[model samples]
Each structure stands twice: as structure tokens, then as C-alpha cells.
Target chain A: MKHAFLDEYSGLQSPMHRLDPRAKLVGLVALVVICVSTPPDLYAAFAAYLGLELILVLISRLPWKHVLGRMLIVLPFILVVAVFLPFFNKGGGSYNLGPFTVSAHGLLVLWNVAIKSTVSVLAVILLSSTTPFPELLKGLEKLRVPRLLTTIMSFMYRYIFVLSDELQRMRRARDSRGWSGKWLWQAKVIGHMIAALFLRSYERGERVYAAMLARGYDGGLRTIYLYDFGAVELGFVALVTLFPLAARLLAVG
Target chain B: MHIPDGFLNSGVSIATGVVAAGAVGYGLYKAREELDEKSVPMLALCAAFVFAAQMLNFPVAGGTSGHFLGGILAAVLLGPWLGSLVIALVLLVQCLGFADGGLTALGANVFNMAVIGTILSYYFFYGIKALLPKSRTAFLAATGAVAWLSVMLASGAAAVELAVSGTTPLSVTLPAMLGVHAIIGVGEAVITVLVVGTVLAVRPDLVKTYGYQPPVPRFEEAEVNQ
Candidate 1:
């Protein structure tokens, strides 16, 4: 039940950490959109975008290993998608690379997916590392995302740990009963465990509702005001937006 | 598989995004009618349970391990509407909080895993449940089969989206995704059957199929959840 820190680096003190969560949210989306929109041939722009990400990473002072590890999680999936692009893309000029006739445009598509996904995934890692989950949800709420969605997200974050603990206990109980699931028939027991977990969760949900009802949970949920973006935060937002635009303008299309 | 940004073009992203938003909006509207004040926490908690369960890697044949997708299980344990909404919200947390998936590509991801996963799985369960014998064993087998098929179908949906996005050609992407997911489907089915089967055996009332009741709690003596 050890909690993984999706926002592990959020508590660190730095300029990036201090920026308003909404600004960061909008800025991160802008970063991804700008990166994705840039043409594949714009290598210089891609390089500059990566540079911006590196600078943000340096400012946040998160462990390089951690950020790199996070990027690696999706790198393989992106690679899988990019791996086939060079082969099936029929519209491009062809080149003999030892055996396979690789298309030039296909190569460009590969480069497009590789570099863009790297930068985009990096930007996402930057956003998650910089902003705490609660603040991130509050940011979304402030940006006028539906109240119901935000409330669910908040509850999700809180209860994920408790439920994981329950799961671990079930696993331990199963192990104690000498069930290791080597045989196909063992799925029967695992089925029972999942059912047990669901029942417990259902019961817990009802209890949670009754408690909420006690405190007057009117159909809608509301949160008090606590976040504000100052002049400096606004400037940070402008910088993130402008950097990508600058790269787009400067990088040869 | 969680698709990142830049893999999809704007046209495809916007199209899927609109579909996803429309589904979410409809889900919220329906949930308001279907859910009592008590149901909201349950929905959120079940969503969190899915999140937690996903982290638990169960070892399959040979040496590799696989995680639970939980779309079918969620749809069966709760109804389809809430189940899909639960999964969609889980995607939001993963995308925004964990950066596991891209923000711009959220729509496509949700469309593939949540919308397609729940709707397809629920109907498959219903169709299969009708054909099977009226026994707990038959029900568990049907649930497992649906879970396995749900993964394949969801992956197929993603493959189509990727092909449509021109990220890769349909000829190449479809078979590749389907082949890889066919293996992942085994794990999904096993987990779903095990968990759902156990719940049915112990407390049939909690299983949320059309006929079975979900064991309403007696709230006369309300105790706070600690």
C-alpha cells in the first residue's frame, strides 16, 4: 500500500513550484499543443522546446532520475507506435537502409513522433512534478471544470490509499491460506477476493454517504476560495506560452 | 495502452474529445438521477478502488505480471452509466495528476477505455449472461469472458483512433495492437472473474446486475466512516 508520489516533487521550493496551479495547467496544455502542432522538420524548434523543459526541470530541482524514469514509462509505448511508421508510410521518398526501403517522409514521421512525444511527455512530467494534486484539482475547478468532477477526483485521491491497504490485506490472507495461483482453478479464489473487496467498498460508500448526509451534503459540493495568481505568476504563464510560440516562429517550417 | 500527445492530429483529437465530453456530460446528467446522496461517495470510492487495483500486478503464466483494467467489473458492480463515469474520472486523475496520459489526448483515451470499454462490456455481459446457464459458475465464466473481450475491443477502438489520426496505417496498427492486447486480455479476465465471482458468491446482493439487488444499507443508526 505504499503511495506512489505522482506529485512527489510538488512540495519543493522554487519559482516553478510557486506559480499558480491554473497558470501551470494552461501553460502545460499550451506547451503540449505547441509542441504537437510544430511540423516534424522543425528540429531546431523541437530542440528549443526540449531546452525549455530542461530549464523548468532544473528550476524544480526534482531528481533527474525520477523525471527520466517517469518519461521511460511511456517511452516504450510511443516507440511501439513510431516503430511501424517508417515501414507502412507509402507517400514518402524511399531510401535503402541495408535491407528495408525506408521512406524519407516516414523517417520524418518517426522523428516527429519520437521528439514530439519526448518533449510532450517531458512537459507533462514537469506539470505533475511541479503542482500538487489537490492544488491541481483546485486549479481545474477554478478554470470552471464541473464541480462534480473535481469533487470525485478529490475523493479518488483520498480513498485510493485506503482501498490499496484493503487489497494488500486480502492478498496476505490468500497467501496465508496457501493460495499462490499457479493453477488455472485458482482464479476462482481470486474472483472471491475481488468480490469481497467490492462488497466492502460498497458498504464503505454507503457509510460515507450517511456521514455526509449528517453534515448536510446538498446534491452539489462547494469549496471555499483560497488560490490567487499574482503578477509574477501571470508573467510565468506568459513565459511558458511565449517560449513555444517563439520556437514555432523561429524554427524553419 | 495510454497514448501520449503528438501521436494524434488535431482533427482526430478534437473529434474524439467532443465525443468524450458529450459522454461525460450525459453521464453526469444520468448519474444525478441514478445516484442518491450516498451514491456519490460510492462512485468516487469505486473509482479509487479501480485505481488501487490497477497498481496491484498479478503474475500470469511464465514470469510476467498484468494489471486489472476494471471497466467491466465497474460496469457490473455499478451500472453502466456510473461505471463509465467512474473510469473517465480515473483517467482524468491519471492524466492531470500522474501525467500517465496526455491532457490534449484525454478525449481519445477516455473514448477508448471508458466509453467503449463500459458500453461494449456491459452489453456483452448481458448478451452472454442470457445464453449461459443460470448458475454462479456460468455467471463467473461469462463475466471473465466479457472482461477479456472488453480489453480486446477497447484496444481495437484505440487502434481505429490511431489509424484515423494517421499516426499509423490501419493495416499495421490494428493487428499489432490487437495481438498485444489479446495477451493483456487474459489478465483482465482473470482479475475480473476472480473479484466479481468472489463478490457474487459471498454477497450476491452487492452484484449490480439488473435482477440482483446491491444490498441497501440500513441507515437508521448512522455511524461516521473513520
Candidate 2:
């Protein structure tokens, strides 16, 4: 039951992996905001953003295949917008592509969604892949995110694999019982499975709580500090922030 | 209804972000005072349950499959405050961990799926259940209807966000989004009813909103069992 799909590459040794999670979180999120906010027509700015991302990827030493594969997650959303491209062609100038008459405005909209979503998704992937999930949660806690929420999230991350493995076993059992999920009535079986899963998870939760109490757990979860935001982290934050801002401004100017 | 980034303009993103932040912050604050020691672990496990349950994809019409949207289901099982918090945590994890949703659009996604999908739908469920008779049938029926409505509401909210972002006019995104979700909502309703009904039968006490009491065995039946 080894499901580390969320941050598979996080343990790899690299410059990106060494930075404080808080710095990476803030810097990468800022990059995403700036990248998404830039006008669709600013091709140069978009290129700069893309270039910055490429440089970071290279520096991080993440495999191109991993990054490219993750980029595919955004394709469904991009395709949804792309499908309506023709209908969006209103007053904006129209372009004839054989049988289809798509508007320039519609094309712009597609580009906007496609590029921005791709870039934003890439940033998130880089952040997640470079930083282990626990460290990232710690970063969030230090960065003023609510302690309660972070604690819950950490727990969720911890048990997600266990529950999902449980789900997989259930699915296998169902399939073995000739439950092809073809007929509409088969939904009842799935429902029962979900309910059973909930019950099992709830019981497990109770047991975990009991175990925690036995170990002198006093409601609040505590961990020793491992991250320090010193010169390197600050410089990384500044470089990420100012470079994107400069690209955006230069493009606007 | 996980909206990716760039689908919404910064204005819509920021506005929804503020609203989502405010609501989730309040939820966190309330949970501290409201949830007891055991509930902390319970809530976390429930969130994990949701993430896992959503992966259980069931078949729909026309050779297609649809997955469960467990917002109303969660709210029904665990009151609105914890329910919405669970959905929010799932969305956040999906956004960062899987890159399933965009970083910039996390706020909008949380607003749509967590806020509108869970909290608003729970109130709707309460109203609908009140109107219906207090039988298991009525309860399951109400769950189905509200589950459908929750999906519709969430998709409608997303369409509005897109329109407000000026990504596409409401004329286009609205009909399109609602049209697709209308089908998806049926799947949502069916699964929600079945899941809720199953839980109600096995462990009615676990259902916070349902409050269904299992029938007590008669003396004759108990004697026979013995």
C-alpha cells in the first residue's frame, strides 16, 4: 500500500527540495497569481513566465516526463473551453478554418484558459513534487494558516492511502462478484460500499484517538521546528517574486 | 466543480477568495469550540473518507460513468460546519497534491464546492426534509433531491464565476454547465440516496441530519432470536 502519488519526487535531493517550504509556498503562489493575471495578449510575458518555470524545473532536476505527465491533468479543463471556442465567436473578428468559423476573441479565451491553467498547474506540481507533504503542511501552519485546518489536513494525508487501499479492496471484491457497474441498479452496491467504508473509517478514527490518548496526547498536536527562513530562502522568495513582476511590467509597458 | 485557474479573472478569484477565507476561518474558529477531543480525529478521518469515496465511480446512462460529489452527503452525515470543512480540506489537498484544481482558483473552487455545495445544500436539505413526512422513504427521497440540487447549485455558481470573469458570457457557460451537470446530478442523487439509506439502516446514529431510529425488535422476535 505504497501510494505516494501526491509527492512522489519530493524526497529527491535538489535545490528546490532544500528551500524552506514556506518560502517555496509563498514564492510559487505569487508566481502563479502574477502569471494568471497577465493579459492573454501579452505573449512575451507568458513566454517569460514559461521560461522562468523551465529554468526552475531544470534547477530542481525534476524529470521532464514527470512534469509533462502532470501537465495533462489540466487538459480536460482546457478541452472543455476549447470545445466552446466556436460558440464564443461574437463581435470579435472571425477567422475561417475550413468549415469552422471561430472568432479571434474566442481564440483568445481558449489561450487564456489553456496557458494560465497549464502554468498554474505546473507551479503547483513543482511545489508539491519538490516538498514532502508533511513539510508543506508545516509550512502552511507557520504561514498563518489555521492550526486546526492544517492538523486535519495532515491527518487526512496520513490516512488517505489506507482508506483508498480499503476502497480498492472493496472494488475488487465487487468486481469479482460480477458487479460490472453496467446497470443503473448497480449503484446500490456502490452506495453500500461507500457506507461500509465510512463505518470502517469511523471505527479506525476512534481507535486512533484512543491510541493518541494513551501516549499522553493533549488535544493539540506538537512537532519540533525543522525549517528556518534565512538568507537562502529569502533570496529565493525575492527572485521568484521580482522576476515575475518585472516580466509582467515589461510586457505591459 | 473544481475550477482551474485562469477560467476566472483575478477579480472574481480574489472576491471569492476573500469570502471563502472568511467563511472557512469562521468554521475553524467554531470547530475549536464545538468539536470535542474525539471529533478532531473523527473529522479528519471523515475527510479522508470523502476523498476515497469520490473515487468510487459508478455508471450512468449512455455508456458513460459519473463519480460521486459527496458534499450534501457529508453535510447530512456530519453537520454543516464540519461537513463544509471536510470538503474544503479535500479540495485543498486535490489542488496541491494532485494538481487537480488550479492554485489561483483554489478560493473559487472552495467557495463553489465547499460553501455552496455543502453548507447551502444542507439548509436546503433541512427545509425539504421538514416538508416531507418523517419516514425512511421520505428521508432518502429528500436526500436524493437535495443532492441533485446541490450539484446544480454548485455548477450554476461556477458558471456565474466564469461569466463574471468575462471568460464566456452567461448565455454560453450557463446553459452548457447546467446542461452537463443536470445529467451528473442524477448520478449524484442516486448514489447519495443509496449511501444515506445504507448508512441509515446499519448505523442511523452516525447520520447527524438523518436522526433515524432503527426499529426495536418485538418481544416475540427477541425470544425467537434467543
CAPRI-style docking class of model 1 based on DockQ: acceptable
Q: Which candidate is the best by lDDT?
A: 2
Tell me candidate 1's interface RMSD. 2.0
Candidate number achieving the greatest DockQ relative to the actual structure: 2
TM-score of chain A of each: 0.91, 0.95
Per residue, candidate 1 scores C-alpha lDDT tens digits across B1-226 of 6888878889988988998898888788777778855556977888888887787666666546667789998888787888898899889888876677777789989988888888667888999989988788888898888888989999898888878877788888889989988988887888787787667667777777836755677778777899
User: What local distance difference test score does each model get?
Assistant: 0.81, 0.87
lDDT of 2: 0.87
